[model samples]
Target: MDSYDIIIVGGGPGGLTAGIYAGRQGTKNLILDKDLAGGIGREVPEMENYPGYENISGLKLTEIMKTQAEKNTEIHEFENVLNIEKNDDGFTVKTDKNEYLTKTVILATGSSHSHLNVPGEEEFLGRGVSYCATCDGLFFQSRDIIMVGGGNSALQEAIYLKNLGCNVTIVHRRDEFRAQKHLQNMVKAEGISVIYNATVEEIKGDMIVESVVLKDTKTEELSEMKTDGVFISVGYIPHTELAVQLGVNLDETGHIIVDKEQKTNVEYVYAIGDVCVGLKQWVVACGEGAVAATSAYHDIKQG
Candidate 1:
């Protein structure tokens, strides 16, 4: 077993930003991530909203942040935390491979892509259905595909696919898009077609995806459209199971409840980023991370 001043769960921008701040304050910290360090943000093809950079890929932004954080913090990738416990001294974090002790723990585990739960969706998960456009867009190069959702990611990824010579059709449950105006305009400018007030009923295929079945929200009519793949991006569910199990307070929607300082109900425990209640944005997450780290540093100094 090892010990540290701070332990951050999840390696998204929020966790990495926390590491940068904690490290600069001379706090011994460790960051644990289940898979790649970049989190879902890495899947974005282009990021125009993050400050300082006019245009940067999510992967590039994550890389730059990770590099700076590594100057002071230790990051362990591919480590899935199984459980966390609070004890008299501090905290204990158990991962699939090992365990560690830390005075404070920051929960930054982000959200995952939501599924349509329609028939054949499970059967064609890898064959023709995917949640990540950046990872699977190449597979459908020059082919037609369906994008589900009306969020920023859905539109952004649709634009990426369009640039790859693939025709894209976006299906949203509502007539209006929730994505930024710029992104919506971009999708239209790129000639991506949209299906509004529609929902997926099923994904039909032989071995691979052949088409998608859709239901009209207003009329309850069913229609089928041919496509090579379906990219789901409806919304995200926060990875808050661990935090909930640890007795952390959460909202009705399962987001961790936190204060302005990012402190959770549990002592020495904090929550930030997509896991907490707030607008799920990279900049917002990073700001929360900074606040959590600074709060933790001062709290430790007091004790």
Candidate 2:
């Protein structure tokens, strides 16, 4: 197996940023990822939070990051990672196509969006079902849409939808929302309807998402509600299976636990970005990638 000083997994903002830092430091590195880097941000239609750009498309941002990473670091695209095994000298990363041995590894694999497993949810994925509010909110302009979740993101997206002239209805399984007090109050005062203690049992439609079946969490009563589209705002789960198999420590939330240096519990192993147990965001992931790559450089050079 070919060996490199550092190998970064994921290829998103975190992975790309890590590659940049490592390449600048004159370290040989490789970036292995399955999809467009930048994680979920790639789907975001407009990104205003990231500095340097006023308003940018998520796909464009991903391309820019990918170009920078590819020019500086060797990248393996569209490779499905299967497992990671640690050896006496270093670690081995196994994928569908090839295997690589590296002295230091960075886990930048981000999280996956939580989506409904209903019939229409899968069949009509791009037709009606959406996950990113900033991405597909414009498609349902002035139309009625239903959001499923009670977290901060759900309320935030609900308000965003309402601002875009779409009638918003929030369906949550819990009677009380887990969102912040300020947002909860703001959405309520803004005329957003709340359907509490109800869960979506099925998403039904032939061409698009025509409606959803809601079952009461407490009373078990069922009702069919017609809507133009459905947004699943549930939380995310980390992409941490390979890390775990390699004896990396992952928290209860399925996120790899890392320190300020982005080093995991295992030696010569580091994890950065949303896959790690911390706030999940593009900016944060980029910062963590820098830290992990720098730390690995220092540690590897010292040894």
Candidate 3:
């Protein structure tokens, strides 16, 4: 069985940053990711707020972080973590491929895309409904589609889709957008149609997405609009199954509860990034990762 001083249970910016800091502290650490190391960060089309870079794509940013982390710690991609158990000595992390022991653990599992849960959504998942514009935008090129949500992601993806010549229309349940001013301006500048205070009541189609049923939140009036697809960019749900199994405390929203040092209620366990309750930004995740790694180093050293 492989053993280490710390094992980070994700490979996103947060997990990769933790690996880098942990390695700098001379702690033998490993990073395990179920899919690729970037997590949802890869889905971001562009990021302008992160420090040190005026403009960069999320994929490019995370790729750079992954490269830096690889120089310091071991990272295993495509390895799904199944369970984690605490022992008298340390902790055991079990994955689909193998298991390893580590003195401390950092949970950076991150979050996943949220769904509308409306009718016809599940049935037309691959047909025309999607959550990622970067991954599926090309499929709807020169066609009409509706973007659901009002956050930065929703607006960003809508702009991306519009740039791809996909005639993008934004359907947000809120009257005002929650995205940054820059993003909102970009949407307006792109001439993308925005339907405020409207939510998707149902997605309608035969084999693929043909139209959507929308309900006006204030007026309580329902209407149908023809479309080629539905791109949902509502929000995200934190990944807390592993945290729950490991006895980590979480907030009402299922985000891991952590202290300033990213230390969880469990003594040797810490959490960071979107999995923890905080601003879900790449820079914030990276900061939390550094703190968690430093805390783990101190704990291991004092022991």
Candidate 4:
């Protein structure tokens, strides 16, 4: 088996960013990813607040980072690591297609959104439907958009979308919101529309998302509302199957427990980005990736 100083799993922002940093430090870092290097960000339509430029497409941003990563480290594409093990020294990572050994492993697989699982939700993905508000909100400028969920992220994003000139509507299954009181007040003050005790029954559109059939929780009545796009922010599920199999400790919320430096409890192992228990965001993931790589570098240097 080929071995390296580090073997990173997941090729998204966190993993790819970490690869660049680790490779720069002269570490023979290798990256293995089930998906491409972009992760959810790549799937996003647009990204307007990623720093640097005023705006950039998620796919484009991913491509830039990916190109830099390729120059720094060796990348093994299309391999989904199924299991992990630790020996007296280094670690072993087994994927469906291959195996690898490395002194350090950084987990940056990221997480998947909690799907509505409703009819047409899957069918409308990318066709006037999305998950990241900051990523796809601009596409619906001046058009009505329905956001599912009433949490801070949802309400806040709705407010942001409103600022972007989109008529915003917030739909939640509960009559009352579970977000911070201030945020609830802000959404109300912003004149953003709210639909209470409602759940989207189905998304309908001929070519793109045109409207949604919403069902009232109390009356079971269904009604259709016109919209150009939909943003789902209900929740997310961490990509922790690999971490679980490797005996890494996870918080009650199922995110891998990491230190301030993004190092996991396991020696020479680390977790970063949304998969770890902490803030989840594009900038935060990049920061965490840098921290993880720096910590690993120091640890290896001392060893």
Candidate 5:
């Protein structure tokens, strides 16, 4: 089995950042990702909130980070980590392709998109319903679509769809948007229709998505709306299965519980990014990654 000073379990911005810092600390580390290195951040069409550039795609930003990280540490993509077992010295990480032993482990396994959990949601997943606009926006061009959510991601995708010549309508359960003021403003500026105090009761379609059943939160009245497709951007649910396997503590919401230094309840183990409780932002994840790496280095050096 290959061994490393540190092993990061996700290659998103957080894990990549950790690898960079670990390398700088002169620790032999490796990053393992199940899919592409960027995770869901790459699905973002455009990100305006991240520091540095005025406007940049999430793919581009994470790509830059990935490049820098590769220079520092070894990153293996398409490696699905199946389990982590604590040992006397550290931990044994078992993946589909290989096994690795590390003195410390940093779990940066981000989050996945939350599903609507309504009828037809699963049945018509690719036929009409999608969680990533950048991935499926082109197919809906010039078609009418409904965006479900009130967050920044929802509004951003709504704008992207609108720009793609799709007549976009935002169906949010809240009266007001939860997105940033700038994003809300852009939504209005783009003339995207919004249905407030409403939620998707069901996604109805035959071979493909044809319409949706919407329920009003205030009045409890259900109505049907016509649309070619439904894009769900509600939010993300943190990926904490690995944390659970390691007996790491989690909050009420199931996010990994980490201290100020990003240390988990288990010794020689830490977590960062969406898997940890905090503002689920790229910048925040990057910062936590640095902290976790430094903490791991200090602990390893002390012993």
Candidate 6:
């Protein structure tokens, strides 16, 4: 058994930021992640909005943060936390490799991409349907692909696919995009076709994706479009299963509920970033991480 003043779950921007602050504050801290520290940030093709860098690759930005965080804290990778239980003192964190007792636990687990839940979508996951354009776009050069969603992720990934010599079509349930205006303009300028007010009803393919059945959101009409690939980028849902199992309060959407100080209902436990109630943004997550660390530092100091 190992013990620490703080144990942060997750290794994304939020978790790394919390680690840096907590470690710098003289708190004995450790960061545990199921995989590498980068999380989804690593999969992003480009990030133009992060402060201090006009533009940076998501992987590079994550590496910078991870380097900084590791300087003051121990990072345990490839350790998936299986369960968390409340104790008289604090909490017992059970991971695949070890158990950790901590005075404070910050849940920065972030989120996972939401699935389209359409038939053949799951059947063709590795064949011709994907969520990451950066990872799968190269496999589809010169092919027609359908990109789902109208958010920043969808728009950004569509631009990436367009650059890869693929004919890209963006399908959205709303007529207007939820992405930034600049991104919308960029998508149009890139000549990507947009199918507005539509939803993907089903994906059709035998061994691979060949077409998608779409429904008009406003009209009760259905149509089919043939494509070589399908990229579903609707959005993400917070990874809050551990928090939920431990009796932590959550919002209606399953996001961990946290106070301004990032403290959860359970004492000494905190939540931050996309797992909490707020706009999901990298900068916001970093800021919340800082706040959560400071809050933990104070709580531990007072004790």
Candidate lDDT values, in order: 0.93, 0.86, 0.94, 0.86, 0.94, 0.91
* lDDT by residue for model 5 (83-116), tens: 9999987899999999999999999999999999
lDDT, candidate 4, equals 0.86
Report residue 82 deviation for candidate 4 (angstroms).
1.4
Clashing pairs in 3: none
TM-score of each: 0.98, 0.83, 0.98, 0.76, 0.98, 0.97
What's the distance in Å from true for residue 60, model 4? 1.8
lDDT of 1 by residue, 1-303 (tens): 799999999999999999999999999999999998889989989989999999999999999999998997999999999999888779989999999999999999999988888899999999989999889999999898999999998999999988988889999999999999999999879989999999999999999999999999999999999999999998899999889878999899989999999999998899999999999889999999999999999988887
Candidate 6 lDDT over residue span 1-303, tens digit each: 888999999999899999999999998999999999978878788878888988787888998999899898999999999998889778899999999999889999989899989889889998999988888999999999999999999999999899999999999999899999989999989999999999999999887888899999999699999999999899898899899887899888888988899999988999988888999888999999999999999998897
Question: Candidate 2: which pairs clash?
Answer: 12-37, 12-38, 13-38
Instruction: Please provide, for model 3 over 36-104, each residue's C-alpha lDDT reduced to its tens digit, 9 standing for 90 to 100.
Output: 999999989888899999989889998899999999999999999999999989999999999999999
> How far is 241's C-alpha from truth in model 4 (Å)?
0.7
Error of 5 at 159 (Å): 1.3
Clashes of each: 0, 3, 0, 0, 0, 0
Cα lDDT over the full model 1: 0.93
lDDT of 5 at 54: 84
Model 4 worst lDDT window (10 residues): 41-50
Better of 2 and 5 by lDDT: 5
Which stretches in model 3 have alpha-carbon errors above 4 Å? none
> Which has the higher TM-score value, candidate number 3 or candidate number 6?
3
RMSD per candidate (Å) reads 0.8, 3.2, 0.9, 4.3, 0.9, 1.1
